[model samples]
Target: MNPLRLSPSRVNDYLNCPQLYKYRAIDLLPEEISLDAERGTLVHTILERLFDAPAPTRTPELAFALLPTSWEEQLIARPGLREKVQNDKEWIDRVRALLTTYFTLESPATFEPTEREVHVEVNLTESIYLHGYIDRLDIAPSGEVRIVDYKTGKSPKPGWEEKALFQLWIYAFIYWRTMGVLPKLLQLIYLGNGELLRNAPTEADLLRTEKKLISIAEEIVYSIENVSWRPRPSRLCDWCSFKNICPAFAK
Candidate 1:
């Protein structure tokens, strides 16, 4: 029997390196998730909980104060890889300030969060299908949907608008199809730096994304069907959390 499989993040890692993907996702390696990743998860949890509360009781101010304190302690306990670039004080203060800035910048009055977690089997066609979890979906008073995905680190090619951003585009489209209404917007929040980036999803945008996904999926299916893949090395191998055990990066 085939196991339940493939979350969006895991699928992304597979795109990064199939071997590493198989080792971590399929083989189930016992590797430590990074402290930085843990920190981001913690931050998202606080922000999500803050939003998910009853509108009458929703409190972004309290959340802004509480979140960074927790994160500050976490940073102190496990400085991790960031210790070199920043001292304990700088890391804690900068993170705290960023949270304060985000609280000031974002208008919780404009919308409410519906942190959607779905593992749906989408019918891409008669034979093709897709599965993923949308991190968060928001709704405006005017009934427009919005998708927000949190990113924790600096991406090497962050400026390019088309850097495999198909994930959020598809997320927005799938959300609308499920709800029978189009999303008004989709945003990517770079939490580490508090840079909130916005993109408006149009009909043409979703169609382009759909075609791209099919192309990428076809590539994956072909490679899996024929077992046709070559090992390639790159920047990821050097800094990847899996570098210690990765065959491509092994000393």
Candidate 2:
């Protein structure tokens, strides 16, 4: 009855496993957030706050300084997180190391981002609306735009990069549709491994991605109406919070 609202993540969830999709999106079940997800949120918050200062003032040391406050708030807001951080000083060290690795790849002071964690959305069709937050957006003097996403984990291996690149393409497609300009660059920064992955999306590439997303949307709608969302068992299930209640693994 309502228009289908979707984000890149929601689409990917359905594509990965419709049953998982139904559990979270359709049934609106609750699941515990992971420590890695909490850490990623903290890192993103620190990076966003880092750029709030003048470009010259956006140094790694300042970014590091921002972490204690950011982390304290996280622990307070999510008291469950205290146990994870209380005894593990290395956890904080690992986050600081990620900040250091970020400096090695690019200087925050070099280019001021037009937006950070920007919420961008577009209506692909009358029934399908796509939306998501981009980690950062940069515009050069010459008018070229760049979309950047940060990964707290390692970069995917050779063949696995396709999925990562596909995610970028989704962002580019949404941006182009919403803004009427193709971005000059799409980048992923993997802090764990200090690796950078960049791509320049062609009009044709984004069009293909747009088509794929629409198709995915249609499939999701069909599954929801028919109550046919089925479980997809895979290695990822080991990390899935819903596994305990999942139809495929239910006791």
Where does candidate 2 have its weakest 10-residue lDDT segment?
A: 79-88
Q: For model 2, what is the error of residue 140's alpha carbon versus the real structure, in angstroms, after optimal superposition?
A: 0.8
Model 1: per-residue lDDT, tens digit, 1-251? Answer: 23334445666666777766666655677665465666576566566656655565545566755675666565576545445434666655654554555565476555567555444445655555556766677776778777777666543356666664667777766665566677788777665566766888888887786676676666656656676643456786765766676666557
Point out where model 1 deviates above 4 Å.
1-6, 54-61, 64-95, 116-121, 125-129, 154-159
- Residue-wise C-alpha lDDT for candidate 2, range 17-41, written one tens digit per residue: 9999998898888777688898899
Worst 10-residue lDDT window for candidate 1 reads 1-10
- The top-ranked prediction according to lDDT is 2
Error of 1 at 69 (Å): 10
List per-candidate RMSD values in Å. Answer: 4.5, 1.2
lDDT of each: 0.63, 0.89
In order of appearance, the predictions have TM-scores of 0.75, 0.96
lDDT of the structure predicted as candidate 1: 0.63
